[model samples]
Target: MSQGVEFNRLMLEMRSMQADAMVRQKPVASTPEPGAPSFSEMLGQAVGKVNETQQASSQLSTAFEMGTSGVDLTDVMIASQKASVSFQAMTQVRNKLVQAYQDIMQMPV
Candidate 1:
């Protein structure tokens, strides 16, 4: 559908804008507090949230298929779409990270 295409384009544009902003951001190196989460920890948490969203969507779809009461078609559809979008976004992030890693590896010391 055209709407879906448009939505995807918009999402990609937003992601590019975000990446650009991050590229232009100034780094402030400060010592981490003893109890603070590291960068990897935050990334893992984000991935976990994406996984949770997909799992929730799967559960809702299963419930609807089983004719569970109070599970509206609209809600199921929305959940599925949300899960799909999140998964796609996560995939894009992974791709970008891989590309960055490759770029870094190619750089000469």
Candidate 2:
């Protein structure tokens, strides 16, 4: 295959992997009850997942930098991008939460 075709194939594979990961990460819908996970627990879990992704990306990059034969440049790039996007998403969520807290603080009793 041509160089362009090969690159495109790799990109497609990366995207498919990302989508599958996201699908697997989604929680199943369930009725909220006293025994259910609290909002704080859910948020904590989300943050933990983001941290895991960043750590995974770091480890992959380290291996690639070490010239590991099993590490592919394309895989490293994909992992880095995934980590970046997830981090950005988490940051946005944090910003929104802070803003909401500030708004509530300023509200009249």
Candidate 3:
């Protein structure tokens, strides 16, 4: 009778621990608010950031070319490269968006 009681107690403790573990491991899910923009909005924001970076880079290049006291050749080169990369990335994104739209249109409805 004592052994039976001990076994039952152990099983209860194990079940309680399992329940606690499961509760702790529950996944968190979030739903976006109404009127929130979707993936395209996020993508547009990212592209805008890139464009801003490119513009800053161009300004830096101009400053360097004008023989500004604080500007250096290396700084200008790096800025130019950064701007070029951003421009290329934006171009690629535009191309991909266009292609996706075309593919969707071509899909049989």
Evaluated with TM-score, which candidate comes out highest? 1
TM-score preference between candidates 1 and 2, better one: 1
- For model 2, what is the error of residue 54's alpha carbon versus the real structure, in angstroms, after optimal superposition? 0.4
TM-score of 1: 0.72
Candidate 1: Cα lDDT at 79: 74
Summarize candidate 1's per-residue lDDT along 21-44 as a digit string, tens digits: 565444568565576566677568
39 in model 3: Cα distance from truth in Å? 2.2
lDDT of 2: 0.76
Writing each residue's lDDT as its tens digit, candidate 2 over 69-98 gives: 999988888778777877887798899999
Q: List candidate 2 segments past 4 Å from native.
A: 1-32
**Candidate 1, position 35, lDDT:** 61
